[model samples]
Target: MPRPRTGRRVRTLLAAALTTLAPLVFLTGPAQAAPAAAGAWTPAPAPVVSHVETDDPVVFITIDDGWATEEAAGARQLLLERRIPASLFLLPDAYERDRDYYRTLLAHGPSRIENHTTTHPDLTTLTEAGQRAEICGARDRQLAAFGDGPRLLRPAGGATYNWPYHNADTRTAAPACGAEAIVMWTHDLTTWGSWTPPTPELKAGDIVLLHMGPTLEADLTRALEAADAAGLSPAPLRDYLLG
Candidate 1:
């Protein structure tokens, strides 16, 4: 039931065309993640955009996972009333399990959903095939369920990003899934409870992360209020990167 991705197909054809003309031109190796530095990639299919480097008056709020039965409703309500923008990195199965809950979130407006993974695994530990399965499989499910939902990839267990070693799939999975970027956060705000990191506050161009958890509602409320008091305007990740 997933909608076809015209862009993915186009990339496929373009690769073929370039392959046939190989004798006439030169090409660089595909962009990779291993030399995993701390920022965005220079080339297209750039897997990750950790933080934007502009003085724009925008901060980003991105919530991770879905079907968190305890706090999803409260989080959804807070997002709706505040009219603050947030980008949610969702697990496809989790969202599908509670379609009615997430459906209301979409209806509430001012939010966009992006990809987390199908089963939520550490991509650095998986083979390339496994990485693609996790990334593309989840995206396909999201498309099937929500009709073109989720266009960014956030590898599971991203908190350990500072760890010295990572496989190439960490970056390649983004393009493999036909995702725009491998989105990473500047701050993992633990105020609302945490699975990964504990960040202090929002700043201009900071990408904030929170999880769906017991304290999600209270944590998000405090964070949102603090962000407003500090005069930071929230925007979707896509808008900040593209626009």
Candidate 2:
């Protein structure tokens, strides 16, 4: 029989529910969006933060899920050299394991680390209390580590069939946990596997997604170079969304 999932394993198994969704709401919307002002705390119209409709010339490079390694260490330097501004949504486990590693990225420059969650769970199936624990727990850890920035929750989600994945409870729990928005992605570079989507060219205000891994060095190098070739300047998600 298939192994009965438990705890974190259940999370891994349940996440498969989101495998068939193609989230491109913002980019598909109007070409012009009045940029938001600073200190805006409103959530995007969707429960997840896939992309935002903005009439700006800049694109955002957002990296999620930390798997610290020498490759990532080197990538941080490349980030500095290239002056790539990125938003990192870090899981508490990854952060705890590589606190100093990510701190180096934060210490170096404009890269900001937000919360992904405490235990990398699929929030859709969780109860209110469970969602709160994940969101609030991650926010607390991020604050303790990265100090302060945007309280955005980049819930541990990917897959397609699911849009936001986090149910109504997730919405209620996020603000309580200090998250302003539940950030998702518009385009993802599946660095861990061989299924990378064809990223033709990054458009203005597009949110490009990446994950930390052994392939990050090559993947980031390639992605940033593409951004440059496409004339899309990478910007911080905080400014692009909340202004």
Candidate 3:
């Protein structure tokens, strides 16, 4: 069930505050043992997926995770009815929570599941082995559930470290782990509330990111409307990438 919006807002604010405060508290404490200068670990460039570019009136809609209950089903139905294509970035564990639910989503036309890690973690902070495990494990689980492998990956939280975070080089982990492309959002509606859809602009090639929770249907509907207004039609991410 979706948490009350009021409560969720308060919790989000508190969590942000605590995240900001924790580092200060740690830094002010008595001098902890200074660690040796660590060897620089460089992040490899993220793989470039061709689907991100185009002059056509289309946008890529990507939904993350499998936690949405009826909200997801409604969104799937809406998308199918509209003949819109979308991609799902699934956290394998979450999908496991309700295998039948995810299968229902797959049964809906114009959708594909992609990897979002077995356990969502900061890949840059994780050891190479840890990263591989998280990435590959999710891929394996999705394959078992859906009878196919994911070709794209999106990192948790969109946060990166290990030097040059957004540099193309920093994104190599996913592809090396088997994903053919890495997806990042071009616009964020996080401030409007999770259930509220952002005003979508029907650019030739816009990649819109959304969560699986409340307002997903509303958001996608708004996005589709916006695309229509801009004289664009949504197309498959695969069309651009594999073509």
Q: Which candidate is the best by lDDT?
A: 2
Question: Cα RMSD (Å) between model 1 and the true structure?
Answer: 10.7
TM-score winner between candidates 1 and 3: 1
lDDT (CA) per prediction: 0.65, 0.66, 0.62
The alpha-carbon lDDT assigned to residue 86 of candidate 3 equals 78
Q: How do all models score by TM-score? A: 0.73, 0.76, 0.71
lDDT by residue for model 2 (79-159), tens: 777777788887777777878877777787788887777877778878767888887887777777778744667776534
As a TM-score, model 2 comes out at 0.76
lDDT of 3 by residue, 1-243 (tens): 333455345434643453354322211111122222244332322344323555666778887776755556777778778767778888887777778766766686678888888877666666555676888888888888889898777777433323211222224346556675566665543324534544745567777776776667777777777777988777777666642
Give the 10-residue window scoring lowest on summed lDDT in candidate 3: 25-34
Q: Which stretches of candidate 3 lie over 4 Å from their true place?
A: 1-51, 158-170, 190-200
Among all windows of 10 consecutive residues in model 1, the one with the lowest summed lDDT is: 21-30
Model 2 lDDT on a 0 to 1 scale: 0.66
Clashes of each: 1, 8, 11
